[model samples]
Target: MYYIVMNMNCEDCGRYIPHSVYKYIGFCEEQGKVVFNEPPTNCDTVSKTTMDSLSSVFGSLGWVYCIDCKAPIFEMEEAVKHIASHHLITTRFMYDSVAAEEVGAVS
Candidate 1:
């Protein structure tokens, strides 16, 4: 687990951002790109799906931004959590509770 102090300033506020490199996906030298490992068995289904969707959207070069300020947040999962925690705002998932309810109804 490595913590990286980002030298870049926030685009919205110009504040320095610090992030945990290990909290999000990481690059593998042998693989030549960032890779998402398998989620832990304890992980919730929604979170796993969120990560998969984010990876697909951003691929290896995606940047997660703060929902409120549009500043560069950490990576996908961490950014979502950060928004909920720090900003008290929910990060909207495409497969959100409404979708879950619809699926539940169909089943």
Candidate 2:
């Protein structure tokens, strides 16, 4: 259940930016590109993945946050399953309803 807390700005409830994806160079949503040495500010929005320097040594260095469950997941496969089963179905249903409305309007 341990995770590597990140030190950068990010979108809150940032969907599924697997912490493993960003190994180095934190992303600044404002800048819209990967940059280095940005003064680490309120990392509340970061993906909250895993580890700093020593994490590699200890090997607790891979994790991703789940917005709906509000927890850290250690494996990508498990994360995919979780999102697919828990979130995508609801999203698909909502999109289908909206699509129906759009079709009705068009007709």
Candidate 3:
């Protein structure tokens, strides 16, 4: 199963962003599905066109990190499990606050 660490805050760095950090396991399969942070609503069909347009812009954008301590997590699943067992994080979000600063460079 793929894991997505969403709405996580980094304790060490205190970088809190909403719906930015994402992690995916089992992404190599051709038939795999991309799970969003929130579930799709009934209005998805009506918003399909807008979503498609946004996809081209944001499809290649993603961030990954530890849910706790905000350390750079290289081995995702195992590291996350370890952190969860030992550390207590009060918040969760997608992007690390440090990473959020770099967004200006993308343009």
Clashes of each: 0, 2, 10
Give Cα distance to truth, residue 53, candidate 2, Å. Answer: 21
> Which lDDT tens digits does candidate 3 get at residues 60-86?
432234434555444434444644464
lDDT of 2 at 47: 39
Candidate 2 per-residue lDDT over residues 1-107, each given as its tens digit: 33423433332213222222232233345445544434446343443333242234224546545445645667656655654443210110001224445455553
TM-score of each: 0.26, 0.26, 0.22
lDDT at 27, model 1: 30
TM-score of 1: 0.26
Query: Across residues 1-107, which tens digit of lDDT does each residue of candidate 1 receive?
Result: 22221221121111112122222233323334433432323322212223354555456546655534545644666665653454311222122235445455553
Looking at candidate 3, what is the lDDT of residue 14?
A: 23
Task: State how far residue 54 of model 2 sits from its true place (Å).
Answer: 21
Range of the 10 consecutive residues with the lowest summed lDDT in candidate 2 = 88-97
RMSD per candidate (Å) reads 14.6, 12.9, 14.1
Q: Any idea what lDDT model 3 has?
A: 0.33
Cα deviation at 38, candidate 3, in Å, is: 13
C-alpha RMSD between model 3 and the true structure: 14.1
lDDT of each: 0.34, 0.37, 0.33
| Angstrom error at residue 31, model 2 | 7.0
